[model samples]
Target: MASNRPAPEAPYEPSRHPETFGYGDFRADEGPWEEWNPTEDSLQQVRGRHRVAKQRGGGLARSSTVLGVGVIAAVGAGGMASANTGKPPVSIAMPDLPSVDSLLGNGSQETPAGSGTALSALGVSSDDSAQGADDAGEALRNRIMAQAERQQGQAENKATAAADQRILAAAAQAEKVAATQAADAKEKAAAEVKKQAEAERLAKLAKQYTLPTSSYTITSTFGQAGAMWSSGYHTGLDFAAPTGTLIKAIHSGTITEAGWAGSYGYRTILTLNDGTELWFCHQSSISVKTGQKVATGEIIGRVGATGNVTGPHLHLEVHPGGQATGIDPMTWLRGKGLNP
Candidate 1:
C-alpha cells in the first residue's frame, strides 16, 4: 500500500488549512474578521455615558448642599424676625445638618450671616430690658409701702377710740360719786340746824314754869283704886309732906277760889290763861283769896290731911275748862319740861 498513496501526506495537516486559521473565506471589501476595530460614533457614545454619570453625581452633591443652606437661612431668618418684632418665637423641625457658618468657612467675618440681615434683628436692646425690669420693681415697692401705711393708720385710730371710751367711763363714775357725797352732806347739815332750833325753844319755856310744891313725897297717882275717897277712886295726885309744907302756884294765873269746901278742908283753885284750872285740895290752910291775880311760884296754900285722906298729904288736880274730870298732873307738868 505504500506505493501510490504517498504515505498519506502525513495525515493531512488541518492546523495548516486556511479555513482552520480563518483565512480561507477572507474578503477585502468586507471588513476583516480577525481584526475588529470600533468606529468613531461608537467611541463617542461610550464617552458620553461616562460624562453624564460624572455630571449627575456632581449635581446631586451640589443640590444637597444648597438644600442644607436654604433650610439654615430660613430658620435663622424666622428666629431673627420674631425676636426683633417682639413676637413669639417660631419653632421649626429640621434634619440635623452642618452649621451655615461651618459650611461657609471660607467666607469673610463681616459677611451678612443669617438670611443676609444685620444683628439688630435678634431681640430688644439690653438697656431697654434693664430699665423695664427696674420700673416694675419700683412700682411693686411703692404699692407695698402704701398698704403698710394705711394699716398702721387704722390701728392707731382704733387705739385712740378705745382711750376715749375709757376716759368717758371714768368721768361718769367720778360724777356719780360726787353727787352721792353732796346729798349726804346736805342731809347731815339739815339735821344739825333742826336740832339747834329745838334746843333754843326748850330753853325759853323753862323760865315760865314752876313746880307746885317743894320737898314733897308722891304717895299716889291721879287715878288709883281705893275705897277711901267719895268718888270711889283717887281723883288727884297726892303729895305726902309734913304739916305746914309750903305749896306754890305752878304758873302766873288768877285765883278763882280759896276756902274750906267739905272734905277738902283748906282748898284753892287757880285758873290759867289757857282756860286750864289747877285745884289745891286737902290743904291745911289757904294763902290766896278768890279773884286774886297771882304770880308764878307764889304761896297759894299749905299741905295738910284732908279730902277723905288717911294721912296728911296735898291732893293736886288739873281740869280743863268747864270739865270736872281731872287729868294726871305729873303728865301735864312733864309737857312743860317739868319731871315732877
Candidate 2:
C-alpha cells in the first residue's frame, strides 16, 4: 500500500526488518524534525556535499602525483637499459592494484579493487625496478671490461713474440758474422805459418853454403857456343878477374884432384859429401892437395887464364853425382835462394 500523508521522521533502521517497509513505518508521531539530534553512526551514512567534493578532489591529486612519479622512474630505467645495450627501450607491464589498507595505513576492510586511485592501486614498486636496472648496468660494464682486458693481453703476447723473433734473427746474424771472421783469421794464420817455415829453411841453407868467388864479374856463361872452345860449346861458367884473384872452395869438400891436365894449366877438383864434383880450371895457383879436406869458403886457388881462354878468368863447372855432363851452375845456385 502507498500513503502520501507523511514520510518517516527517522531514517530506516535496517536492524528491525519486517521483510518490507511502507510510508510512515519509521515515524515518531509526536516528535518534530528540529528537536531530533542524529546519532554518530547515522551521520556517517550520508556525507555533506562539500565534504564529498573535497575527498574526490584530494584522491585525484594524489593519484596524479603518484602516477607521474611512477612513469618517470619507469622511463628513466628504460632509457638507461637502452643506452647500455644499444637496443630498444623495454616496456614495463602495469601491475595489479595495491590494497587500500597498504595505501592508507588505515583500518580499511577494502581490497585492492576498492583502492581510491589507480596509481596507488598498483602493486609494483618503482624502487625495485630501478635497482634491477642498476644491477644490469653493472653487469654489462663488467663484461665489457673483461673483454677489453682479454684482447689487450692477446695483443701483448703477439708483440712479445715478434720481439723475440727479432732478437733471435739478430743473434743468428751476429753468429754468422763471427763465423766468417773466424774462418778468415784461420786462413791468414795458416798462410803466415807457411811463410815462416820457408824463411827458416832458407836461413838454415845459408849457414852451410858459400859462393865460389867474391867481387868477380861473370865473363861467360855455361853452354855458350863459340870457336874459343874446342868442343864448339863452353861447358862451364867463366868469372873474369885480375890475375891472382882469390877463388873460394864454395862448400866443405875433399879435394879429389889438384894438378894440371892437358889444356888445363892449373886445375882443382872438389868432391862434396854427396858425391857432386866442383871443377875449378884455368887457375894461376892451386892451394889444395889431393885427398885434402877443405872448409867452406876456403881460398882454394887464384884466378888466371891457364886453360884455352883469352883473359884472366876462372872456369867453374859442376858435375851432379860426379857425372861428366853438367847442369848450369847459375840455375843450381838459384834453387838455394842465391840470385847470382
Candidate 3:
C-alpha cells in the first residue's frame, strides 16, 4: 500500500551550534535503533547534560519554543479549515524539542537576556508622560484663549467703527439743521429792517406836507370823462363844498398866479421849491397874491363854481416840473403822505 504521508521538507540548519553537540558520525538512512528501559541514574545524567547544554547553547531552547508555538498556531488554523470543508485534517510533524522544565530548570522561570534594559530603554516614566500630556493640554488651552481674545478685539473694533459712523451721521444732520435755522433767522431779520425803514419814510413825508382842504367831499376825480371840460377828459380833482369854503396851500410854495383866467374864472397857481406846480382853480376868491410866498396850510382861496360851472367846488391839478400835462392830484396828495 502507498503511504499517505506528505513529502518531508528540507532539514533546518541552525546558524549557531553548541561546542559539545557535534554531528561528525550522524547517518539518516543507516540507523538501527536499540530500545532500553530508563533508570533513575540515567535520567539524572540526561537532565544534568541538558542543563549543561542549555547553558552553553545561549538562547537555542527559547528560539525552538517560539518556533514550536508558531507551528501549533498554523496547524490549529489549518485544522479548522479542514473541518469546515469536510476533509481530513493535515498532519504536521513536530521536531524533538527539550521539555519546558529542562529548558528553564525544575520550577524556575526563564527571562530573555537584557529584557529589563530593553524595557527601560523603550518606556517612559509615568511622571514624565503625565507632564507632557499636561503641557500639551496647556498649550492647546493657551491657543484657544488667544484666539478668543483676538476675536473679541475684532468685535470691539467693529462696534467702535459703527458707533463712530453713527456719531458722524448725527453730527452732519445737526449741522444741516442748524444751517437752515440760521438762514431763516437771517432772512427774517432783513425783512424786519426793511419794514422799519419804510415806516420812517412815511412818517417824514406826513410831517412835510398837508391836505389842500378839509370837510369836503371828492366830487370828480382826475381823468373823469364828460362834456363839462375843455379837454377830452377831466385833468384835475374836484372837491365839492359850500361857497366861501377856505382853501389852503398844500405845501410851502410861492403863489405864481392868483387871478381870473378864461375857463378857470378864479384861479391860483402855486409853485413849490422843486418846480412842481399846484393849480387851485374855480375858486370863489383868491386870498394870496401872485409871487407871494405862502407856508403849508395857509389860506390860499375859497371854493366856488366859476368858469364852466356846474356846482360849488374846488378843482385842483398838479404838474411836476411845470409840465403842460398834469398828473392825478389824488395820487400826488397820497405820495406826500396825505390820504385825500
Whose TM-score is greatest here?
Answer: 3
lDDT of 2 by residue, 88-202 (tens): 3444544333343433333432223221222321333456545556777788899999999999999999999999999999999999999999999999999999888877876
Instruction: Please write out the lDDT profile of model 3 over residues 201-313, one tens digit for every residue.
Output: 76787887888888899988999998877788899999889999999998999999989888987999999999999999989999989889999899999999889878989
Q: Once model 3 is optimally superposed onto the true structure by TM-score, how far is the C-alpha of residue 76 displaced, in angstroms? A: 33
In model 2, which runs have C-alpha deviations exceeding 4 angstroms?
1-205, 218-240, 258-267, 281-285, 305-319, 323-340
**Weakest lDDT window of 10 consecutive positions for candidate 1:** 27-36
Candidate 1 overall Cα lDDT vs. reference?
Answer: 0.68
What lDDT is reached at residue 300 by model 1? 88
lDDT of 2 at 148: 99
10 residues in a row with least lDDT, candidate 3:
113-122
Write down the TM-score for model 2: 0.48
Superior candidate under lDDT, 2 versus 3:
3
Cα lDDT computed for each candidate against the true fold = 0.68, 0.70, 0.72
In Å, residue 301's CA in model 3 sits off its true spot by: 0.6
Name the weakest run of 10 consecutive residues (lDDT summed) in model 2.
15-24
